[model samples]
Target: MKILVVDDDPGIRELVRITLQDAGYAVAAAAEAIGALSMLEAENPDLAIVDVMMPGMDGFALTRELKSFKDMPVLLLTAKGALEDKERGFRAGSDDYVVKPFEPKELLFRVEAILRRYGKEEEAPILAGPLEIDRQSYEVTCGSRTLLLPLKEFELLTILASRPNVVFERERLLELVWGLDYEGDGGTLSVHIKRIRGRLEGLTDRVSIVTVRGVGYKMEILP
Candidate 1:
């Protein structure tokens, strides 16, 4: 998974970046909130580690803004560990808070916990417009029609439909669906997407997989 680290302090940014990178997560860092917001689309990070104290926009404001922009989880890191400050952070849509002068292991633990919670939440059936994706049964149902897909196609559709309108990068999709060791070109992904698209075309018009040009693909839920 990819993580975005936002902090004004260069030292803290590097420290967090190294910590996450060492744990096998792709890391991106920005010195301020604005730059972090700008990186949202291109980075498509699964989680964001945001420092609460900054020059222009504080972590609280940034957390709210980030939630409005994407569905990813946010962890607020700050020196303030008081009740009111933590309440404020939580009120601003932060999934978790980590006080400064923290142990790297503790930070990593909290990150894993939050991610686990999110994964559990997504374990339920996903309803995207007219499509219903059941991860358990590996079934895709569109209205009254039940569409069966190959293993790769089903996994790809499950990922896209689970997060409607979220742009999933091609490499990320490959890793999630085809496994990290899969030695395949982008053409394989394209072929599978084409097949899924063909299946959806015959089933429903409200849901579609949109090719995002240089990016990858996203499930678009049309009205």
Candidate 2:
């Protein structure tokens, strides 16, 4: 899973980044709230770790904004550990809160707990028109035909098919399907999309991957 760390403290940001990265998570860091907001789309983070005290926008306000913008869960990290501060964090839509002097293991545990609560541990089968994507089996079936796609192809298709007709930004898709550390260009993504389209062509014509011109791609289910 991917996590975004938003903090003004350089030391805190680096520490959290290293901690999460060591736990096998893709980490993205932002120095402040504005930068964090800007990275939201491209980062496509599953969760956000935000500091309470910020210059422009505080963590509580950012939590509200983040919750409003997406269904992503936010974990507020701050020095404040009072009962009222905790209540305020919850009121502001934070999924969880961690005090500044927290142990690295504790933070990881909390992150895992929140993700499990969000159902990120397991995904259900997705049905888009005639296509049925079984995430567990990594199989796509249309009618009587079954298409066994490559790992990357399957993940890419699954991401698009999960939200039919919703345009996925190219950068977002790359980060989701590939990884935060992917050094490749858009050509790789284009090629994968092309391959998926070719494989799906023989299985069914009802489902399609539509290019959104300069934006990215979306899955379309035709009647």
Candidate 3:
């Protein structure tokens, strides 16, 4: 897991870096909100530790902005321990609150708890347009209709729908859907695609698997 520590104070920032790193996580530290946003553009952190009462944008404001784009958790660290302060943090989309001069062990526990909550959600069904795939239940649904596809066909569909509109080449899809060790010609891929299309036919007009001719296929969601 990766964590981004945002604090104006070098001491607090470095402390968080050391603590999380020792706990077996990758760490990135930034001075303030602007620098944190810049870091986000380059790399994505699994969680962010933000400090309240910064110079320009406070932790509450930063947490709000980050949550607007990402679905990850934000933890607030501050000197204030009043109930109102905690409420404000929650209002700003903070998943947890840690007071200043926090016990390192407690911080670690809270971080783990927050991550555990989201981990379950990550495995749940993924939805795009009218298509939905639930890995846990091994179910695929299009609109009100449920699809019953063979193992390979279902895997192929899930692979494409996971990243809708992103064109995947034949070699890449084969490598991902069928293991590299599998000895199968590319014609097998075409056959599976046809079967998947047949299952999707008339289920929903909003989604379709589009062939890229010489390339491979992509699950396209129509507006």
Q: Write the per-residue lDDT of candidate 2 for residues 1-223, one digit (tens) a residue.
A: 7999999999999878866764457899999999999999998999999999999999999999899988789999999999999999999999999997776767877998898999875355778899989967999988898889999999789778877888888987776666556799999999999999999888888889999999999999999
lDDT of 3 at 51: 96
| Candidate lDDT (C-alpha), each | 0.85, 0.87, 0.82
Candidate with top TM-score is: 2
Across residues 1-223, which tens digit of lDDT does each residue of candidate 3 receive? 7888999999988777865754446898898998998899677888999999898999999999889868669999998999999999999999999998776656876887898888822455778787788765778887677877788887788778777888878986776566546588999999999888888775877788999989989988888
Which runs in model 1 stand beyond 4 Å of their true positions?
120-223
TM-score of each: 0.54, 0.55, 0.54
* TM accuracy, model 1: 0.54
TM-score of 3: 0.54
**Alpha carbon deviation, residue 208, candidate 3 (Å):** 58
Local accuracy of candidate 1 as per-residue lDDT tens digits, 30-67: 99999999999999988889999999999999999988
Q: How accurate is candidate 2 locally (lDDT)?
A: 0.87
Q: Choose 1 or 2, whichever is better by TM-score.
A: 2
Q: What's each prediction's clash count?
A: 0, 0, 0
The TM-score between candidate 2 and the true structure equals: 0.55
